[model samples]
Target: MKPISFIWILSVWMSLDFIMHGASTDPFDFDQVIHFKIEIPDAGIEILRQSNFQRRWPDSSHRPKVKAEVRINDEPFKDVSVRLKGAAGSFRSIDSKPALTINLDSHIKDQQFEGYDKFYLNNSVQDRSYCNEIICRELFQRAGIPTPRATHATVELNGRDLGLYVMIEGFNKKWLKRHFDQIGGNLYDSGFLKDIHANLTVNVGKNPEDHSAKNNLIAAVYEKDLSKLLPGIMRHLDLDMFLTHVALDTLTWNWDGYAMKPNNYRLYHNLDTGKFQFIPHGMDQMFQNPQGSIYPRFRGVTVLSLMRLPAMQQQYFKRMLHLYGTVFKPKQLVNRVDQLAAVIEPELKKRSLREWDRNQRGIQRLKDSIGARGDFLGWELSAPERALKFPDAGFVSIRNWKTSRLRGDIQFRNANENNKQVLVIESGSGINIGRWYSQQLLTQGTYRFEARVRCENVVAAPNDLYGGVRVRASGSRINAVLTGTRNWTWVAADFLVSQPVEEVELSCEFRGMQGRTWFEEGSLRLVKLR
Candidate 1:
């Protein structure tokens, strides 16, 4: 063949290969900073201005979108859809640097910018270091949980530089395709603070029909019998993945996430596996409490239910231990934060020297917190497990309960009730979820928890599932509570321990809008069944 012909043929073959394989690289490249310039017309700017001043969050249906022209790394793209996006902490006015979501294919079908159909530019006001989201997501991904990738970006909107922002992969068909075998499944976004049972916004599939998957999972969670419940849950939910997700969330101290708070998550109905998997989101604030508990009081209904099963609890602990040893390496995480800061600091300096300095301090605090958290979790996980020792009567008078404050204003103290020193959990004129709880380890068996409880002016929150005053034991099936003014009453909850060695938390809880609850400390007893 002629040399010229051979050269032309080789060049054409290389071009085809580039077209086919180049898209495989991540658009949200962790090692690089993306440059984005968004141009919006005056009308679009006005819409943002109006929404910014609204007292309430704009309804999604009413949230107006405006046409925009975007340039990614000097490569221009036209006819994109742009809108302001944020929740409570991160939302900003148009005059300030606002978070934004852009859809490249909103107007022009099949159009994608840098292999991304949709993406988010977060202002990172809640995350001073601008690395929390990226780092947390990376940790989750390392633990085999499918999380959206994130990277740093310098964004300019309508000629106004927005400084440094965290660019994140949006949940959509493309993101699904990258993570799962089945991309056609429904992806449910836990909008704002909603959970699985709520009318979640479907991000990528038909909603009314897709809602059935979540319903099925909820149904499975309601099965009280352990034999039936475990199998039922496994049929509709990926328990293995869910356990790992929870472990990572807990170790990272993601108090605002789904497993802990029933918020900031995505539930995807994997068509291929026919099981739902939770995806973590809004993880900008992490390690805020480095010594936070590895086993927090779960608020998500599904997670709480599973936690009641002792066998499942063992699996969860195993998952946490494995992930901590393998994925939650403190030195490695700190190094990652330093590497990210190196890439981000220069760009941040170009934006504002003062902010850049502040970011350096924030990054140091984050690193310190990461190290502290790793030490705490390692110690907590490695400690020898303890089992409650029973006396000749086969009962133990539970004492030395610690206080746990869930939300709003709450107070716990010892007070004289009927000439006895009783533990009191009082709501300080607001909604509250406070508990005096003690954790005890037990072997597989049936047990009875008994307590004397009293309440005055107790008004339960309409949405509080546990309701008013109650005595609950984790790792068992016990749903009983009391409301309204009542004299000291004897209450008992029978629970069954189903593991060789399982730790269970017994709580004297007051969950209400307003109330003063008293528990006879001397009367609290745990009796092993004959």
Candidate 2:
């Protein structure tokens, strides 16, 4: 089999020639909407309907592709394979205009669509403004992160006019060549709410069985010692680039990205440097929570572990400041959104007046959020760091927790146990992640959190991601849990506060079905490590 290739140098020359000769032709143009018409046979449409009817997340084995004829801006491409694509938030049935993945060279070898072999047509349900993806991608690219290009499109499938969609460049061999100098590596997709610790499916690779690169990266992230954590991670990751990615994610308020959640991302193990690089995806929801924390609670294992070090924390903050000063321009972004709306809103109005109204309102909201985000980021970056107060004993007893019912029915109250006011959490009939959490402002340092707990009939929730009944601080790598019947034994987890001052959440959570757990009062304490 011949290795897939993209003529990078020739493409560069053509780009220069186009610029020099003032040619009005270029692919991946974001200034205008590209009209796409897809003609699939009845059998192909049925296959798509069946695929969309499943309504499950996109995976390798479940989604099947059917042949179709595609036309882009009046240009034709026959013998293409089209498959329905989306996760939980953006998925729609074929009748309701589903998202699609169009592969140009699947059946026809060496076929290209405007110098691209594959592309995505996103159903812009999550982003009513239809501008977040492009804006966020531009921000990431400006911040020196290798992100895929995105633009607006109006797609018509089988004569049924689907409304405006966000057309994104696909992560194929051409994309790899475009971004990297060397292209021999594995590309792993963060499939459907999965993290790096799970078995991530390889999207592009030479040998799927050889997963040493990914394993090494995970092992580095799992390093327990704070002293060795950054060095270990640096061995397997492009640390600076990764930190820049995190900074951009934070500035954009990408709540669903790799820095916040372990979803909507891609990891590429670069062969030239033997390091992993993160790529952001599913960014339609960026900037939604404009005032969300700059110091976000990281959920990804890699970021959580590296963030435990004070040096890494400082570097992260510095990167955020740099990117904010350089790449994040609120007025420019809002103007871009206006420009996009001007081009897309008319097309949208032609489709549905109701949709156009909704989109206009959404666009206004999006612009306001972008401006608010810029103000918030400026204030956060300019504020002076405050040092937290600690006693001479270097320890504090935790108290005054608020109850949070995450799922199902959970009862929380204070009770007398062994002559002490113990906090109790009782689970109802269904499974729950009942938590009694307290937040405290703390300075940068290492600390150990300990709580004496006793449990009764603590049946662990099936596939519980947080373990069983346990006392832990948010964003900590400590794994300590107590299940079933147990005496008043101390359960402890070590945590490191990396910021100058941060509000850390200490949680006594019971993640189980039908369990009663008691956390002995006056025993919950945080002791500074150094």
Give me candidate 1's TM-score against the actual structure.
0.72
Separate clash counts for every candidate: 0, 0
lDDT per residue for candidate 2 within 1-530, as digits (tens), equals 86645787788888887776556554665377888999999988787777743335345435779999989998898999899888878878788979999899998898986688888999989999999999999888888888999988889998988979999989878899999878879899888778888888888888767899899989889988878778888999999899999888899999899989879999998888889999999899989889988888899888888877777888888888888888998999999999889989789888889999999999999999999999998877764444345689887888788999988888999999669989999988887777888887777778888888999989887787665798889889857688889988988989877685567899998888887999987998989997
- TM-scores for every predicted model: 0.72, 0.72
lDDT tens per residue, model 1, 1-530: 64578888899988886776653556565378889999988888898776542335424523568899999888788999888887778878777988888888889998876688888899999889999999999999888888989998899888998899998998888888888787777888887777688888778874536477788898899888878998999999988999998888899999999888888899999888989999998999999999998778899888888988877887887888899889999999999999999999889888899999999989999999999999998877864355777889899999888999999889999988568989998898668888999988776678988999889989988877777888888966646789999998998888887654568899888888887989999999999995
What pairs collide in candidate 2? Answer: none
Query: Of the candidates shown, which would achieve the greatest lDDT relative to the real structure?
Result: 2
